[model samples]
Target: MNKPECSRLYKVATKHVCALLLCFCLSLSGLYRVSAQDIELKNPSLETKVLSSMLPDGWKRFEQSPDVQPGACGITQSPYAGNTYIGMMASPDWSERIVQELVTPLQANKTYTVSFKLAYPPEYFSSSVCSGSFAIYGANELTEKGEILWKSPAIMHQDWKPYTAVFSTTKAYKYFITGPYMDTICHNAYRAVLLDDFSPYMREVPQIIVQARNSCKGEQTGSATVRVKAGQPPYRYRWEPGNFSDSIVKNLEKGTYKVTVTGANGAAATTFVAIGENELTADVTSSAPICHGDTNGIIKLNISGGVSPYAFSIDGGVSYQDEPLFEHLKAGNYDIEVKDGFNCILNVNNFTITEPEPMEITAANASAVSCSSVKNGSVELLVTGGVSPYIYEISGQSRGYDNVVSGLDAGDYIYRVYDQHNCYVEGETVINKEWRDCAVFMPNAFSPNGDGMNDIFRAKVHDAVTEFRMAVYGRWGQLIFESRNPNVGWDGTERGSGLPAGSYLWVVTYTDSKLQEIQQKGTLVLVR
Candidate 1:
């Protein structure tokens, strides 16, 4: 027969079978047995009683064998010794009738294990006839009814066996039907299919839990849920600031907090309940000013009215357990910071540092005075009332005295004093008189010869000189001869060695014992 003829005949046959079953059920007059044993058929035969009707309401008949036969209702092949068999196929595309009326209605928001007895004729087993799936629909008709509740492959053994599938219902549904979509190698040829005792199972929901936040306070205060599976999505959470809607509570003062959490399924759970109090307090004290050179100075900072383990910080860095002693601070203002167990920081407290006053020199002067007119004389400098052990200097051109007057100088001259602070008083004097007869005398000319006549040139001092330096230079100012002690005055021999006769200029300077300058300049001739 052509497809249209075959389809028309199959429809007629399905209507007849459905009408017979309906009439038989109606005639029973509600006298059907409800006993579990009566309902449970022991090894029901598929070939004999399993009737093939049109797919349940709202389901479209998908595939079936062209040759229909009567058969016992067994999960697999025919169970009876001799019987005829008929098979029916259905698809879920039609308003989800299979899942809505059959599978979903049985689940009711529960987990389930569903099982069915199904079989396919050997001829249907091929690469093209391999696998198929079934779905349980929900009320929304738009959404997949229940879950994709179950599925099976078209390739089944000739001997039927029970195949099972399991799924959990996340939402409730009013009706459900099982959809069986099959692939067949017999393109134009139809194949037989069978099903029996489709059953569903259910299980309880899992538990929910709450985990407390390990720490809390001020800006750094908050708690978190704990003891949860690593990737489990949290269904609900609440903190002290609010109820079930809020996941995190902020702006917390010092206090204990409570938290509660619920699982997705709304089962098994936990909560953290406690009074959170803002008991934190703090205190600060100003530090004393430190001198510039003082490396160790105590800055008094006392923290009170709070928890222990107070932390200290000079700036906004990591807090330290103990307060630090500041050292080597430049001349300026500084900010000191202190914090408690919580990460609360005190604003910058101003501390001033003053530089030590430069070392002071109170007084310095000559100790005594002497009246003298010569290059050599003695005078004691009484440099008292100054900032300790002053340093003294006599003028370089001052004759008859030491260049540096540490303890004292003997002269009729001046003294410059420097105190420990490196501050100094310009040249000062107690005696203002010239050293008597201290003039430096040198012959205007001389002759260099073997004779005992005026063959050498020298200088003479009338009084005893203390420290003296003299030098003779050619007209161009290049030094020819020099000397320090007056007793070791120059002999005009061109640095104590013989030289060609020439005219030369001489200069002499010395400080007397009284710290007076004895300076002289003249010209001399050496005739060789």
Candidate 2:
């Protein structure tokens, strides 16, 4: 807290403020240089008390003379942020301003935010103080009044206060100025305010806030949202791969995504967001159908992981149910799926409903009935399929492990075969009467000449008749030929001697299917 040997108190009284401005301008270039962006100001807090030789060290006058406040100005309050402060005011005609050549020029068409501390102390200025607004501007030169970047409302605060201004530059700016707000209708009386502790000088970069959601296992169901904060309006957005230009992106898998957001003034920022992984899995236990060709199967499913409120589908998403139990499924292979609240899906493809093999039986080698009225037919049965060791039955009669059934009548017989598991199949077979009606016949005339035509006389017995006999007699009533075989023939011979040609009498007798004897007599001619 050492006192300065000379302050601006004596210089302002003698009106030597021009001498002070000339000294600061000579030192402005020697103070510092900016390497990157216009990110900071020189002597930002006005931290100087050499009022006799300098006008706020790095600052120069743009309008009416401004005061680098000295002890005589009567500000009892300590500096709001630094060792010293500066004061500016509006005269009867124009407002006073202080400008500084920025270390580097700001990029044109880029948005920026500037902040400083301001206060109004009546005695801080030279005796005249009426309420007035504060203003900030961007300039190309230190002498000209640049375009107004921002203007505060009438500031009447007694204590130190903070103010912020955000604006887009029309051109690349070399100098920045701060002054009291003034226009045509400005206050004619003097109005003054104190400024101290400039925050910084830099283009505004928007804040990027990312909100990401997890994705489904083996599916693309995640999401992310990019929000721009503290930047210009009508922001433009972009994403990688798809080149999507929206705030929110959806249907993303487990991966990191990059997004760039650009403000209206062409200031942009890039950020990365990540969508995590979620495992959706399911296990199913099923019951087989009760019997072959039955549809009474059931499945119970248990699910784990992922979001809640799950749904299940058995018939390939055609229908869905909240419960995990499924019923009445046919015997076949199946693929079951479950969906979670986030629409994540899990599928189990190895599910089956099985039953015993169907019963198969073949009825073959059937014996025909001997007579039209008898039940003497039989059939051999072959059983396969179904479980092992099958039991056979015919006409509702259980057979003791016998595949053959005798004494089958001429009708349709219903048969069934039972597996060891009590699974049965019913089938049918028919027994037909093969032989019944028969009659014996003989030709009357046959030539005995050895010309290979009509040389023998025999009875045609259809073979359905048994116990056959045939005989022939000459005109003298003597036996000419006799035979007990139905197929045997008679020639015109007597005792191995050739006989004369004459008419002969023949008789045939045979037994029918009912064991009844049949007799028949006829006359035949023989040629010698």
Which candidate number would show the highest lDDT if scored against the true structure? 2
Error of 2 at 121 (Å): 2.3
Q: Best-fitting candidate, measured by TM-score?
A: 2
Candidate 2 lDDT, tens digit per residue, 388-444? 677778889987667777777777888888877678887878877757644566888
* Every candidate's lDDT: 0.46, 0.73
Clashes of each: 79, 0
- Model 1: per-residue Cα lDDT over 1-528, one tens digit each: 433344466568677765664465445534433221111111222232444434322223322322323322222345223353333333222111232222224334444444565555433212122332334334544343334554555535655567765445566654444444433343433333545444322222223344333233344453444344321244466565455355545444444555555444333234554434324443433333233244444445556533456566665555454753555455456677655554545545566655444333244344321224432233344444335555655654332223233323354455555555444455454433444544557778887686878765666655445567878898788888888865464455664578777788988887664577888888887887
Residues forming the 10-long window of minimal summed lDDT in candidate 1: 34-43
How does candidate 2 score on lDDT?
0.73
- In candidate 2, how many clashes are counted? 0
